[model samples]
Target: MLSWRRSTSATAPGSSLAYGCADFLGGPGARKAHVLRTVMVAAPAGLAVELLLWPVLGASFSGAPLGWGAASGAASAAAFALLHRTLAIGPMNVLSPVTALVSAALPVGVALLHGEHLGAAGLVGLPLALVAVVQVGAGHGAGVARPSRTALLLAFGAGTAIALQLIFLHQAPSDSGVAPLITGRAVSSAVTLAAAGQMHRRLGAERPAYAMSAAASVLDSLANLLFLLAARNGDLTVVAVITALYPAGAVLLARGVLAERVHRGRLIGLGTAAVAVSLLALT
Candidate 1:
């Protein structure tokens, strides 16, 4: 919970935590079931959260917001399908950094084109942010098969789609409220359910991750909500960079909950991320 004026200071970290927790659960859930089937749980759960938030936030029917929401839904659907597919089949060491780096870069590029500058502290923080993401991503899931041409394309596409989802949500008018989120989640859910229905036989045979998926979906939706607020209240470049630090959170969660060792690179990344955030916030 953050006031609109203070949200920029708080929401980015809040969003990062939500995203981290979501990925933590979503990763294991995907391993248990088909990733798309896990999305079946996420779709409805996320949609329900948006619907609940809609009334509290207030919304209006507007063509621009609605169109942007639908576009975001499509991008989100593509990202969820592609990124996980790539990770499932390709080398995590190479492709994960590709996705993470591209996603962080695209939003900052857009923000620059829109004349939003990160200023002096941000200049230093920006490169650190990029380095942090690389370290965070590269430290995990090592030594799978090298990425194929198809996997490379999918990783890049997933990154672009993720960036587009954030940009589209950022484009929604402030007065439009959470309607865009509701519309986007509803569209994505319907698409995911249709895909899951087709794989019902396969999904049925696999272990279900109902509770885990639901919790992840809820947290992911909340993260998006917090991100939208932060973007609205602050420079897009700043918020996007901070939000991309989510992998650091995931790594930390893994250390605490799963008793996994935090590799040196990820530990450095997490520490770097903390310093970058402090500098970005202060100046």
Candidate 2:
């Protein structure tokens, strides 16, 4: 059984935490001040972090890495857009699980096809983890709309883009360091800004929570960095599945900081997640 691979320095768990914090900080602001407007701040904020780290990390902007970075950037931007649109059309509880499933399942399938195996512990833990991700996102409010075909389509699209972003970032060469992220973040920032400009009227006087957006972006950047490192050192299937449990982190954070009520389903999810992580650690 794959209990969190100690060999990877718990990078997957670190990624999950960072991702959860990013979502927690970003989610409210996006919902309140238009997703695109919040993203305008988030994207640039991430770019600034990457720019600062690029030189220290020893960036080498080669063709393949740059291409992958750009692709990842475009995919991330698409994911943000599609995710918000899908949520607007449907409930988060109804649509989020689908997106989360696709994002994890696709990468797991690809990793398996490429000859990565999870062994016994991983086999036991992975399913539980995936289930935990869905359960953790279960809601007491919002997500009241019945999921229609359009919402399903958008959810699937967003998930696909999210998967692609991860895959693209992982595909960058080892020596590429954080250079690819710099390129990727810059591209996403430019695209987000342009979209925000086009939809400025939608923003009206609803200014984004700049500090929260920037904090979220920094957390997201850290998560991506950790994910890339974990993917490089561990089986993609294991790392991706583990990292996808990020929703649990967000839920707990909301409960603690915002005093949001946790549903019974999510409490069970947290319990299951603890079990899953314990099992995966043996791997």
Candidate 3:
């Protein structure tokens, strides 16, 4: 009986040790799944809220070509899914700022192509924004630790997707009364759901994960609706730049909830971005 007890105790520890290693290796994949699932839940909820508010907000449905919006929504969903995946296993400090810069710059370039000239301040701000991206990409400390190539690539893709989303949203007809947004959200949700399914894993097993996912979905939908409205009435450059400041919220949340350390380089990069946004706004 004593020998059996000893053998059982030894087996338990070995099993636990194996479990720990498996958990660590699988962490990234699990996190990716969680993020995608959150998006799936959040997007549909957001769409519902937008639909409910449409009539109250006096939005009218104009017959607009929805191809661009649908395409943009699919792209955005893919980008966001990738972004969350990167953030799960990569450096948030690096990804957030780089993504923000790309998101802001692309719309500005589009605006310029459309004959929207920048003022002196905007001209100056553009360079500063680029510099900020570089600084953030260079790492957030004295040693200048850069993110993995995969992470950087993911960040770039995310930004590009955001820019496309904003640009396409602007193309929506003025009379479309939130229909484009609804269409876009639907597409995004569908894409996200497909991605989650492709993972072949269970989603939101934890209560907290479900709650956070729901909250994120509501906020994301609200943000998308606002961006559509803003882009419809304003310059795409101006609106995109304003919206790109979203990373600031994420940064703060990371600091508060995760207690992540913000090194000097990150601070400098973030500051530069703030100044650039101010100048862009002034221009």
Tell me each candidate's TM-score: 0.94, 0.92, 0.73
Q: Give the TM-score of candidate 3.
A: 0.73
**Which RMSD values do the candidates have, in order?**
2.0, 3.7, 16.1
Candidate 3 lDDT, tens digit per residue, 1-283?
0111122212222222232232222233235445555555566676887677666554444445367668768777867766676776567656766776887789888898998877898789767866765554444543355678888888888889878877887787766666777778778878777877887466656322444455555556556666665665556666666565554444445567569886677678679867876676565
lDDT of 1 by residue, 150-241 (tens): 98898898889898998898898876778778888877888888888887877656764788889999999999999988888888888888
* Span of 10 residues, lowest total lDDT, candidate 1: 1-10
Please give, for residues 182-218, the per-residue lDDT of candidate 2 as tens digits.
8888888888899889888877677778998899999
- How do all the candidates rank in terms of lDDT, highest first? 2, 1, 3
Best by TM-score: 1
lDDT of all the models against the reference?
0.83, 0.83, 0.63
Question: What is the clash tally of candidate 3?
Answer: 3
Residue 243 Cα positional deviation in candidate 1, in Å, after optimal superposition? 1.0
For model 3, name the residue pairs that clash: 42-217, 62-175, 62-176
TM-score head-to-head 1 vs 2, winner: 1
Sequence-dependent TM-score of model 2: 0.92
Task: Flag the better candidate by lDDT, 2 or 3.
Answer: 2
